[model samples]
Target: MKPPPFSYHRAGSGEHAVALLSALGPRAKVLAGGQSLLPMLNLRLADPPHLVDIGRAEDLRILRRAGDRLVIGAATTQSEVEYSSLTAAVPLLAEAVGYVAHPPIRHRGTVVGSMAHAAAVAELPCVALVLDARFTVLGADGVRTVAAGDFFLGPFRTAVGPGELVAEVALPIAAPGTGQAWSEFSLRRGNFPVAGAGVSLTLHHGRVAAVAIGLSGVADRPVRVPSAERILLGAVPDDELITRAAAAATEDLEPRPAADPAAHILPVPVAPVPGFDYRARVARSQVRRALTTALARAGGTR
Candidate 1:
């Protein structure tokens, strides 16, 4: 189905886009790559009065290092992230981008768009949360920063207010001896994970120092497994520790309900758990795998 009637304006710059959105209020939608918003519009889930296109905004497409962090502009495409030299500097981003929808979609989808879309099961947000990334937002007032923890509020929701557009994502450079791992349970390649895990550990000597774990596809939002993180810290990364952490990660996640959607009706999709029991089980399994992989990378003994 075609989207509802709307006015479109190609913005000259980030400030120009923000001005349009502020004037239009909540009735306006900012179009970056038209990846997430277009699909929602076509489905009549969103019917904005106007679209402020910022695809040509040069400042929103650049990637560079700022001080000790990697600053990536909002309109930067997923393909850029997948192939970035920054990913080599920090492989967590590369691993997360690998799990995004296939090449063509990635080529057209913007990183900031995905984060702003705020899908609970999306790989990028989970990775960002695990990395404790910062999100930069542009508004009528000025630019402001929001931590990953505060930015993601719920499925398809964020803390961004009207007239605000994401400007960039900032990732801190990992300290020496830091190790990261990402894992998911997708039925097929390119589909979102049924349940996914992102794990990062800082090692001191042979023990875990600080640990962060983010869970997806199992909650209203990507949730940080704080209990599991505590369990992993200062502990020897052994089978026992990994097992305990995995158990803690899946202990209370209630699987979401699923409708047997007709394949023809909903062509785009993500990993869906078979049932409540199965989803919980898969969450546990993914946690185990992710933590184990991260521990190994951190040079922990088997």
Candidate 2:
């Protein structure tokens, strides 16, 4: 089905987009790459009265390093990031973006758009959360920075207000001696993951000094599992320790039934295996895989 009738305005600049959003309020939606939004619009899942196209907003296409952080503009396409040298600054992000979708889709999908879409299983948000990224949002009241942890409220929900637009996202460059990895389980290439994990670790004197673990497709939002991190801090990187940390990652999660049995969008089309238990298991495995990979990269013995 075609999208509902709506007026389209190509924003001349970031300021113009903000103005349009403020004036249109809840009725207007900002269109970046439109990879996610277009699907929703086509499905009639979203029906806004107006669309402010910010794809041409040059200011929002920035990709640069500021101090110790890599700042990405909301309009920067995933493909731009994937091929940029800046990806080396955040390896986890680079690895995760590869799993977002096919090359064609990535060419048109914006990283900020994925975060703003707030999909529970989206790779970018999980990576952002693990890296403690910050999102800058613009509104009529000016700008406000929201931590990645607090930016996502739930599936398809975020701190972005009706009239506010996410202007940029800032991810801290991994400190020296830090290692990061991203792992996920999907039915096939270019499909949404069933469960995924991103891990960043720093080793000090043969022990885990600092670690961060973020999970996707296992909760209402992308989540950093402090419990799991706590289990690995100051510990030796070993199979036993990694196993315990992986278990901690999913120990407290409550499993829920799958949404639809008839939908083939996911690998498992039945509730029998796609329920909470299944996701938890996948989450555990991914956490283990990510941690192991990160540990190896950090020069720790597996």
Candidate 3:
């Protein structure tokens, strides 16, 4: 089905985009890559009255380093970042972006769009959460930075309010001696994963100094398993300890129900991987694998 009628306005700049959204209020949606919003519109799941296209906003296409952080403009495409040398500052992001759809989609999908889309199983959000990325939102009043941990509220919902748009995202550069890894279990090459996990580990004197574990596809939104991190802090990397941390990461999770059983989708197959128990098991396995990889990269042995 075609999307309902809507007025399209091409924004000349980031400020212009904000102005358009402010004038149109909640009825307007910002179009960056149109990868996420277009699909929703085609499905009749979203029908905005006005679309403020920011595709030409050069200010929102920035990709550079600021101080100790990697600043990515809201309109920057995933593929652009995926292939750029700037990703070296945040290797976890580089690895995670590879899981986002296919090359064609990544060529047009904006990184901020994926975060704002806030899909429960999206790879970017999980990486952002693990890295503690910051989002800058532009509005008529002014701009404000929201931490990734606090930005996502629920499925497809975020802190972006009416008349506001995400202007940029900032990911902190990993300190020396830090290692990161991303692992997921997707049915197909470009499909969303059933369970995914990312880990960032900082080693100090051969022990886990700092650690962050982010999980997806097992909850309503991307989640950080601090409880599991606590288990590994200051501890030597060992198989027994890894097993305990993985168990802690998944012990309290309640897997989301599968999509409607009768959708009869192809390529987009329904989840027949049993129920909560099976998903939790997958989550555990992913957590262990991610931790192992991250630890090895951090120069630790398991």
Candidate 4:
């Protein structure tokens, strides 16, 4: 079905985009990449009265570094980042991009748009959580920076208040001796994982100096497991320790179905969990696998 009627405004710059959104009110939506918004519009899941197209906003089409963090603009496509030098600073973000749908989608899908979309199985949000990515949001009031933990409110929700749009995101560069790994179980190569795990491990003096674990498809929103992270920090992870950490990560993760998917009318996509126990098992094993790989790459193990 075609999307309902709407007024379109092509923004020439970031400030223009924000001003357009501010004037349009809450029912208005910012359009970038159109990878997520278009489909939702066509299905009538979202019927915004106005669309502020920022895809042509040159300022938001940037990819650069800020000191120790890699910054990505709102219009920067995932494919752009995947093949850019910025990935050298945060390889985990690049690896996660490879798992977001397929080549064509990534070519047109904006990274910040995916974060704003806030899909349950999206990999970017999970990676952002682990990498300490900061979202810069622009509104009529002004720009504000938000941490990943505070940015993601829940499934299909975010801290981006109405009249605000994400302008860019900054992800910290991994420290030396750090190993990053992403492990997920998807039915097909590009399909969203039923359960996914991301891990970054920094080894110093043969022990874990710093670590972060991010999980997707196991809960309502992409989440980081500090309980598991706490167990491995400053420790030499062995099989037993890894197993315990994995178990702790999934222990209280109540696997629930995605909800309020008004955009998907195709009999509702299959829920990620067949049984809660089975889903937890998959998520736990992913964490375990990610930890092992990260440890090996960090030179903590053979």
Per residue, candidate 3 scores C-alpha lDDT tens digits across 1-302 of: 78888999999889999999988878899998998788778777678999999988999998999999999998899999999999888989989999999999999999998898888778898899999999999999898999999998877778999889899999989898899999998778898777789999999999899999998877778899988999999988899999999999976766455651211111133346445566677888999999999998888996
Candidate 2 Cα lDDT to native: 0.87
lDDT of each: 0.80, 0.87, 0.86, 0.84
lDDT of 4 at 199: 96
- Please give the lDDT score for candidate 3: 0.86
Tell me the RMSD of model 2 versus the true structure. Answer: 2.7
Clashes in candidate 4: how many?
A: 0
Tens-digit per-residue lDDT, 5-121, candidate 4: 999999999999989898889889989888878877887778899999988999999899889999999989999999997687797887788898899999999999988888766
**lDDT for residue 168 in candidate 3, whole number 0-100:** 94
The per-residue C-alpha lDDT of model 1 at residue 152 equals: 90
Please count the clashing residue pairs in each candidate, in the order shown.
0, 0, 0, 0
Tell me the TM-score of model 3: 0.94
lDDT of 2 by residue, 268-294 (tens): 242233677788899999999999999
Q: Which candidate number maximizes lDDT?
A: 2
The regions of model 4 sitting more than 4 angstroms off are 255-273
Best model per TM-score = 2
Cα deviation in Å at residue 294, candidate 1? 1.5
Off by over 4 Å in 3: 259-274
Cα displacement (angstroms), candidate 4, residue 242, comes to 1.4
